[model samples]
Target: MAEEPLLMNFSLGNDAILVQPKFKGGRWRERRGLRKATGPTGVNTDSILERHSKRQKTGNSDGPTRSIDYQRRTGLRHGVISSLFSYNPKIQSVTDRAEQESTTLPSNAPLVDGIDTFTSLGLSPIIASHLLTKLDIKAPTAIQKTTISRLLSGDTDALIQAETGSGKTLAYLLPIVQRIVQISEQKSKNGNDTNYQIHRDSGLFAIILAPTRELSKQISVVLDSLLGCARWIVSGTVIGGEKRKSEKARLRKGLNILVATPGRLVDHLEHTEVLDVSNVRWLVLDEGDRLMELGFEDDIKKILDKLEQKKGKSGAISDLPSKRTTILCSATMKTNVHKLGEISLKDAIHIQAEADAQQLLQEPTTSTDPIFSAPAQLQQSYIVAPAKQRLVTLYAILKRSFSHKGSVMKAMIFFTCADSVNFHYEVFARKVGQQNTSQLSDSTPELPTQCHSSVLSSVNNPDIMLYKLYGNLTQQMRTATLKAFSRNPNPSILLCTDVASRGLDLPSMDLVIEYDPAFSAEEHLHRIGRTARAGRDGRAIVFLLPGPEELYIPTLKHGFKDKRVNGSLSEDILRKAFAPAIASQTRETWEDNATGWQLEIERWLQSDSKIADLARKAYVSHVRAYSTHVVPERHIFNVKELHLGHLAKAFALRDQPSNMGRGGKGDEGKQDTGKHKGRNRDRSRNPAASDIDNARNSAPDPKEAARQMRKALNAMNPASEFNIA
Candidate 1:
């Protein structure tokens, strides 16, 4: 019998882990200076010491020390000591527990604690006072509870899981300020030590990575305000589809902290060599998982790789490291995400919130809930409509969502595709009175508006609040829209593509509507997360048509579920999709089918004047306005619906053995053990399977599960033999 192998932290001093010789026993000594060797089986103290220096104490001047400040109670004099990583309350995985009901409100519904309060969270009284009086914080959210402690205590990493709007921003923000304040105070205390330039003028200590331009701009603004008030340091932003010269100028000075999007940031890094990542003491990957899906995975890798390279040799981490902390915050985390978490964080501290906190979320509280508390905010609900009627439904949702919020409209509608994004902009502007002809005629001709405040939506009595943003927005328009969205008192509605889905840093969003449900289960989790952010009780409404129900499930990931969540909706969940004709008649609209039809016919007429001459201009307008990319671009005809057989042949994922973790020749994914067969049962529950399972006898698979009986029948019964189909 042997104990299971455990994952251990590597001593930063050297690559070779210190192992003691065992004299025919299982025990090994944990002492210093055992021996020195060379080659494949050798140890080098000087090299180890050099390597270890990267992760040395922030202010340590010595090569080695006997004890680590377990509580991190000593000198962090080299820089700001944020209380974020430390003093984090130890709680359970209560937040992502999931709903008990058969249906969910939104795919990313708060699974666990939507935390509130800091009464006993161990934050210093001075910082707590600042939070209460200066920042107006009442409580902590799930993310805040986990991350704040790690940041404050100066630990390696904090991998946090909770829903959006759980006060994750302040979870990191407050501690960053606190650490800076502490560091500044320390330098003041040691005024006489001007002999060395080791810890000279501060360079950028933090780099925050966001998935979207809007989110990056928003977070940058928030950070500016926090830092501005304290006069801590200067910061700048690098985002896509925006003014390049201006952003480049900002980067030229080299900010004390930088907030950026993956794509644009890559461009900035490529062009600006002196941006100084080597001085980056902290890195924040906001909406990190979304970066992977945005076709930015390569870019993110390139950036991190470059940054790692900047760390001088062995690895970027090998340069001036001191238990470097990596924080991964997201609405939902699945099993595959664990690898991503591992890649981002080092020696991570996994923190999960309780489910009840998420279910019980409403308003901020003053006690017990130290993480954060969102205000009982936006009005949330769903509308029943067919996929064909998606646009009409969107217009209806936007009109009502913003209209009800009053004259000032601040809303962002999400779409799944580029065409959908374009269509909505046109139709909603003209038909819905959100915008119209006059405005469109003058809309910069080539792109959207640049003078954001004056860029009124062209419609009947255009409201003070209205805008459109996506990947295609000209750099100027995108930048202006973001600036306006953040400052304008009037509520504005900005149509969004998947580009904005990952991070919730979009400012003052009281409402979010997913025009089209997410493509994958992961998408659904991140989509509705836009609202209810940073201690604000926001509302998120997901529009689910009937055809998609089978694909929908409650909490398909490690956390999240279709159980009872506070303020959850059950009305919009359309059951039993209608037959073709019935569904078309009831759910479809003129803009959808008519515009789509026109678009297809026109595509065929392209390059032929006679064919084009036959089609009416009105039809073309409708076609361009309503038809989706698949219809207008002829993509639908090109892409054939794939079946299981086709998938088995094309992807061939099924060729691999089921339920195995085998790796390569020597050390495959397999753990080299057969004891844990039932460790992970993948519950790939879908509608078709549910339908078939319902048709089944409610018994386990005969071949797999020895039991032939249904529910009440036990596996122990041998006489319960059943016939196969």
Candidate 2:
């Protein structure tokens, strides 16, 4: 067989040397008998005897050359595998045991005792201090500590699986920045007199692709902050929401680091020809599973193809530094992730972050199910309410949540659809919005007769500054809403759909409320992950009707069973809160009030009264608006049974689940049966005349019923009293 050409990387010692296949044009000459010393910046050739002399001083006394011919024969494509790791037979296992074992270690456990500090990981002075001082990042996270060494070596590819909010963003970013800094320092050492600078027209050195635009922008923001002192390392974002022209201009001006969504990046590749990733040394796919899922496959493939073609063309140039190192990160490993790895990555070292040691020994199998394990610091709970009373319950809960404590709370409220988001936003803004707006005449303002209008005149506790974020909003509006909510220090509630779920980082977020149950467990996990980030404590409450409470919630809990290897329990924080709240007369009052409101609402729908007609029309209009997102007249009460298994896995409950059999599905029928049995037993024992007398006495008076109905209505909406006119 013809010998492979040597593309040596000397940092791994004398036994290690990277091999590149012979080019078609034979531009790369083979030195069969020669030995040479090479650095990351460039290679320097030496005669055999001179190489021996240099090796002797370095204490790497001339060792036998280990053949890495497997790289050429193994059918590996664009991504390059390092020879240093190839020699280890155990690590060569496709289902890597060591990697899995490493993930099972306690999250706080140091990978290596001495190298726990940032500087110890070889980060430059500027970057290290920034992490410690500006970001207040004291030590590397579990994933970071385990993956940083291989990444900084510039030869290893990594597949990292860590929990959401485990600081995966910084894990990859730190190493990439360190490598760039290392290269610049090496350039200065190699007689380059120019200052460390990134050229606008020059090809990109790093590209990080994320699944969502929010994540893309977030990564860009983090990059900007990390490179705060290193101003010369230019970065930019290319995502769907922004203008194509602006992105093209930014690319035309050149960037050292590009954080982008796959689709938009491919658009520039196909249309503009402005981006040059030929020199990209690091490629990161954030949320790798989602990136390769249904919508993203083609665009991701095109981007990878473009990179491969660029690298292949550049391969003939012997002076090129190294092949791009690909890092694929996902919160949960789905079946397609493995396929994506095989297609896009080389022989990569896998790193899984887990809290259980037993999980490390088992081989990972790909599945459609999501892995569910939330941080222990996160407190999970739920509120059980009827469909009609949900809004009433929500208002009560919000009022209590805000008033119960003196501290300000930042909450992210999630719903199922955009229309739901819009309707809720309108209701809450009209009803619960603070009466702090410039008062009419700043004195005795004329109170509107309508209950909804009259409520604006009442000044009490600061009302929640409600903000809406959904798919229907324009890009500008969406960005503005997020910015305003994130920046505001006052108590605020951000009503959104899944658009806020995946990767947006909201600072100081104290709570997450799932106003609508998520479609799956994974969605729930990601939604809750919006809070309790980076070792901070946060609370998450999901609202479910009895039907969902029995069927879906338990299924959600079961989803976490396998993933929670450490044997932690999912303690429902709401048990205490629920007990106290249920004990209050307010609970009974609200239920009665809700029933009356529903009856009134229905009656108003058919009535000719002007006040009733206005409310009925408003309610119908809202429902119609919501229907555009899906089937018309579909009530939010109905929770679908789709993807239950997948959602169960993502739910990540640590508690023993309740029995979900006959009593679990629905209980209203069973209760009704018992009620009839009791009535029959009573009738059998009583005489006919006595039974009749008892029935007459038991029946409520029409006058009393009417009085109760009026009282309930007045309690629900104080403005209804004035609307009577």
Scored by lDDT, the top model is: 2
List, residue by residue over 1-725, the lDDT tens digit for candidate 2.
99999987746655456663321110113133221333343323334324433432433323232112221221112122111111111211011111111122233223442323777767777887887678767777676766776677656788887766778888899888777766666655665665533444445788998876667878988999998867667899987767788888888888889998776787788888767777887889898766653235656788888888887454222223567788999777666688788877898988755442234446343355444345545656665443333554565556556764434468888876553554455445544235522121212223211112221122344545667676545456666677777876667778887778887889888888887766456667788888877767677777754442433444435323323211111112122223335433322222223323233333332342333223322232222222222111123323252222212211111111132211111122131234233222212222331233233234366344333433332232211111110
The residue-by-residue lDDT of candidate 1 on 440-507, one tens digit each, is 53235343432222223335324545556655444455666666665666667767666666654566
In model 1, state the lDDT of residue 124: 55
RMSD to native, candidate 1: 32.2
Q: Which residue pairs of candidate 2 clash?
A: 103-354, 200-253, 200-254, 451-719, 521-647, 559-648, 559-649, 560-652, 570-654, 570-655
Q: What shift in Å separates residue 478 of candidate 1 from its native position after superposition?
A: 1.6
Alpha-carbon local distance difference test for all models: 0.45, 0.54
Per-structure clash totals for the candidates:
72, 10
